[model samples]
Target chain A: MVDKSILLDNKKFTVGIFDDSDKLLHAVNTLKEKGVKIFDCYTPFPVHHLDHALGYHRTNLTIGAFLCGLLGCLSGFTLAYYMNVVDWPMIIGGKPQDISVFTSFIPVMFELTILFTAFGMVIMFFARTRMIHGIKEDLLSRRQTDDHMVLAIDNDQDQSLSNKDILELLKKEGAIEVNDSKEAFNTSLTSEEELTKILKSNKTSTKKTKKK
Target chain B: MYTADIRQPLVTGGKTYSDVTKDVCRPIENKPTPSWWLGFSIAVVLLLVLAGTLAWTVWEGIGTWNVNKSVMWGWDITNFEFWVGIGHAGTLISAILLLFRQKWRMAINRSAEAMTIFAVFCAAIFPLFHMGRVWLGYWPLPLPNAFGSLWVNFNSPLLWDVFAISTYLSVSLVFWYLGLIPDIATVRDRATTKARKFWYGFFAMGWNGSAKSWGRYEVVALILAGISTPLVLSVHTIVSMDFATSVIPGWHTTIFPPYFVAGAIFSGFGMVLTLLLIARHVMNYQDYITTEHLEAMTKVILLTGSIVGLAYITEFVIAAYSGYEYEQYAFANRMFGPYAWAYWTMMFCNLVAPQVFWSKWARTTPWFIFIISIIVNIGMWFERFVIIVTSLHRDFLPSSWVMYHATWVEVGIFLGTFGLFFTCFFMFAKFLPVINMAEVKTIIKDKE
Candidate 1:
């Protein structure tokens, strides 16, 4: 199942834009030291320390890849075994059942092992990231994927620290732009019922509105 | 104050991070240049030739080329191996270099990977048609079907090739496209036309640079690179096995696997030089793919070329030491036989030519390296021809042996595959940034 992008559903975030990674790293560490929760941080490329600063754990993609590789090995080996040994066993040079029979089969086994690992890790990553077709992306700024670094913390659970305090903290720590963006984005994929109902409601409000 | 090292600045012209985006996306923003049109027109015309020649061959039958009583495998197979070897450099550059954390690859990986995909396509066409009845291609797959309830032979090295090449092509495509996601999103945002946004957006698949998304992207790229290293190595080794497993005197040898792998890389880097030298000149990517990058690639060409040269010496020495008459004759015929000129040409181009790289001036001079690269390309094709033709021309029986040369159809088909390869490359150039913009931006500042 794809993980839905639900970070923007809530209206309580202080989006701090930093020009430099060092400044962003410094701000994330300071906020963590003072027990402020970091919702997310985005950059064009990964920063070395920001994950650790945000208390994010290492991903289990390697583990998933290992398991998938094992699956591929078994699948490849079984196919070779069933086709050669079990089904039509044609004797090429009187070595059909030799002990080293599968030695020639290593290349196929190796290929599938790699093939499965690549497919598995990527699919698992896509699921976890919620990057599916037609899904609306919640972009803080277009430059976030180009040159900008963004730090966002949901201001919901920590009610004592107001948006003003977070803004002050961000500005003091050298964020180029600081603002509250609890505003919902035009993201949710509209359902057929929701679309038709909205059209009907609009028609009811306006008598001359054309509706089929 | 931040000052880049003068001798080895990763990027020149003092480009900023934003400049990286602007420079990479410039070709996409501007309309296609006149030179692009000239190249594209040539490529398109050549593609028509490839299609026409294939139609002619299939209609007239495989006998259109003189694969006769003795030499069953000819130019088609040589072309296949050559293209496959050429494709190897792309995956090697992007996957193996990435695993080693050589950041220099970021400048050239996109174009190189695209080349890999296209070259593999060109490689595949030969094998597909080499089987006389191209329509019955699926007969090789294991299933209970029309060719009786027969299954694919698991012991066959050719079967191993099918699995290896298809897997390599698919995985490389996935890796290349996944790496382009964020960069495509940048294109999507900067697009002025509605058509550009729609096309780029559809491919980008909503890849916002969220922390979670970026984290996942890194993990996947790392794993893909790790797997692709083994995949790329095994692919050419398995291709070599198609010859090595055969009992042909020259083809059967223990050193074929490693030597083939080394030669593949040697030849693959040569092709990369040929394409990149032209690309950097035409696309104005000099700042990103700087002189240092060219020097570094020349060093790789020298190293791999040396290994291949050593492999040639090793093969000849072993053949001489072995008392088998056929083995000794095969190597001798390869050197002093009718095709001796081809053999020496291969030697000069593959071994003696790359030695010029020892001089720093040769490596730094783009035009000189470009000339050497073309020579290396020619040498590699001759190497394949020498291996296939010379060995086949002299069988055990003197009466059965016959000297063979490529018919016009055979040469036309060979020339046409280049058309197919370059056409795809031209299309990729038109649509995408040839450099990995997102990754390059990270290294430009070096201010962490």
Candidate 2:
């Protein structure tokens, strides 16, 4: 069970694909209300309030940036001071090596602080997301990042809602398409009208065989 | 249902997510438009001219240009300052506006950032070529060289400029690329062919846009914005110092830093408007880059133009008050002197042209803004000239004074840089999503 979280859980996911963001939001609310465990949501762009509506706390990126900038400031000033005053004394306008020249140091120091924050934040983001070089991940639909919003539920697991019930709920909550899937591949869902036609044809064929 | 915000629809015309993708990605995915082909051809021809002129300058030494001993720094430095100034708008729009949470930037920031990178690239060519033996240009770097352990001087403003410009370019590139990754992933997903898939996928780095990943992307973006705001300010401040630290009366003033920065922003917005007006029309992206974007940008042009004009006036007043004969002559000779035409053209273009934005009609009209932007561009070049030449030509001794004119080669090199700028811009328009796909998606109205 632990090994089969998103992948390798054959025929497990009941998927709901949404065309409109509002419809996706409403579906998310209803799914949460129905006690269905939503596997994930895939959107082309970030839907506002989706994370908060899904019950996550705010990100701590600001605090980390502040600390990194402070470090940059310290290093930038110290290096400039060390290089200019202590290491090699340049006689500018007959003035000696004086700390008063720190006023001039502000621009370079400011640049370095910004430089450090940008690099640090990006590195942190990469490490946190595991979005490193050349990793393979599947998108639920080709248009998932363009137009469609997808909601996935693990139907194979024991939960408060059944797969059929979840599918019905998805259709009720304005999902444009609903299908069953396993291992990230869609198992196309037949419409109810088509299902009835198949059943009726099967009954007629059985009667013909009986007559024969 | 989420209110569609039809009153100020950022994406405009009831566009869906797929529509946004289709529009932004159209140029990249499809064949080149006729205008694109024509523009690229012209740019390539101009670029070849740039190559020939640059080759001649390098081979024949800096003497190919009309820069004499009196006016040692000529059109090259002026062009450098102008292009660098134009680059500032991109960073300001992307990073500073992002920090302020101005949502309108979503539509134009991608192209603006691209503009910044290209402008910086054009600006860099001057300093490198000015070094003559461009191969030895790495001497400014803080590498452990074998030449008697000669180290880069940290005290020199030139060295500071070396650090400042290099840092600005690299940071802006990373910020731009990072912004592109998710969109590239989208492109990767949309690609039908193996080659398309591989190239897009390579750039995308398998960005799945997981909830966690999206959250982290925001973190990185916000922090980069925080860092870039100051870096942008420092870049021009340091550029200003290249002249400020000098004893040259026109160049040395306490107000140079802020004045140069304001001028940079002013000129930058002009270029941004120039490009966006043409881009929106050619690519049919009017829905995204609406009239509203143009109006907003014109306001920036006005504000910065005023600050720059104020700086010009204050410099004149201060020059008169200094009681130094050299300083007094510099400002007096600038207006009523032989190069008075350059001085007034700079004044008319930089200070006078943007004043029309005070009228509502001028701000809203694309054609007007485009015209004004061209005027401002010309004005900025003249401003640099009036500052550099007017001060240099008239010295303490009567024998030392000499007038300078840019030879055809110098003019060609300047025009060629435009070729470099446009060629890069056209290529970017062809390959990258002209409008950022990932960010624009967020602004789409999905009424709750």
Candidate 3:
């Protein structure tokens, strides 16, 4: 029941498409209590406190930003000190170029700190999220990025809850549409310059099995 | 999930999530309208004028302009300061407002931040071309050079500006592009053509709207905003220091930092109003942009205008109170001297024009706000011109004083920058989503 041509492995998912974020949030809470090993949830925009419902840990991107910012600060200071003092020091406007005159370095220091922190944090974000240019998108539904909030549950992984049981739970929790799909998600992305081929060649088509 | 009862909906007409994407991406998906083509053509023509004038300046050397020995920095530095100040409002809206959790900014921040990036590009052109030897632009960097391994002066505010402006531009780009990814992904999903899908999907970077990605996205956005808030304030402060650190009687005032920053925000809002007023009407973004957004912007224009007005009065008072004859004469010359017309024009346009916003009707009216925005832009330009020229023309030695008038080349180059700015903006509007669709979706009132 899997599209072997596109997916890295054969795994079936019971996908639930909800129209409202509130309903999706509620369903995630209830499904977790029912011992459903939900894979992930997708939404058009960030829903308030929905991450808590999914039991997702708070992202440590702030820690990454701080570490990068600290690196930037030191680099800024070193660049200024080495150039102005240790390498070649010239007195301009009668102000001596020395460690005592650290105030003059403040502007460059501030700028470098910001420059590095922004770039570094963004790089960390892209790498951690595995987001980059020229990667094929593994989408459950075309409307997932538009209006629909989707919850993808790996029926193979969750021995506690059957596929039918999860689909029933999703509909009871206010999902507008339910589907038992095998070809929706792929763990391994095609590292391709073949973006043009995706429209004509890819075999995965998101077919909705039932409407609630 | 619910907005406060008293707070007006940021996105009007009860837009749905899909509606937000549809409304914003329509222009990009369809053929360019006649209006878009018309604006683009005009901008391109003006851009040609800039190219011609800059070519003349470079080929003919610095003598092409009418800047005299006494008035060394004429329109070049004035325009540089003006555009830089223009850029501040974008960051203020995007970074500062985001930090304050002002949701109204979500509708406007995307365009405002785009303005900031384009405005900086325009600002950078002035200083870079003003150097005359544009090929040697890399000389500003603190690199070991052929001239005896000499490094740039750390004490010089000019050098500080080189570091500040480049850093500002790069950081602003990073911030803006990060905000665009999710919205670009929305456009990617809706794209029908293979070419459109490839390009949009390329930039969208495989964004699957994962809740985990969004959580990290929030954290990164917050930290960037935190750093950018101070970065925005520091940029204008450094620009002001270009004048304040100098010993020239009029330019050497301690209040220049706060005053210049206020004027930057004032002029920036003015420009934002000018652009958005035209965009909302032509693009049919009234439901998203709304009169409420216009009014909130006018309030900012009003507040910053007052601060700038106060700075003007304080400068004059401080100059008069100081016992130094040169300082007193500088203030008197600006008021009653040869350039009195320019000075009074600044005072009236900046100080008096914005006082009309005290009325709620004036604040909400788009046409009236547009006019005031234009007037604010003009006044701020004059503010820079007055500060640069009046002080330099009649410094300590009266014998060396000479009047400066901008040559046609100077005027054309200044006008050409508008071409550069508009051309970039029009292309941005056509190719990319002008509104932040993702953020707007979050604020859409869910019709349960």
Candidate order by TM-score, decreasing, is 3, 1, 2
| Candidate 3 deviant stretches above 4 angstroms | A1-10, A185-212, B446-448
In model 3, how large is the Cα lDDT of residue A18?
92
Better of 1 and 3 by lDDT: 3
Report chain A TM-scores, every model: 0.81, 0.76, 0.81
**Docking level of model 2:** acceptable
lDDT of 2 at B201: 71
Ranking by lDDT: 3, 1, 2
lDDT of 2 by residue, B340-434 (tens): 99999999998988999999999999898899999988898888888888988887777998999999999999999999999999999998888
Winner on lDDT between 2 and 3 is 3
The TM-score that candidate 1 achieves is: 0.93
lDDT of each: 0.83, 0.81, 0.87
TM-score of each: 0.93, 0.90, 0.94
Interface RMSD of 1: 8.2
Candidate 1: misplaced stretches above 4 Å? A1-4, A10-12, A97-100, A182-212, B1-7
**C-alpha lDDT of residue A102 in model 2:** 85
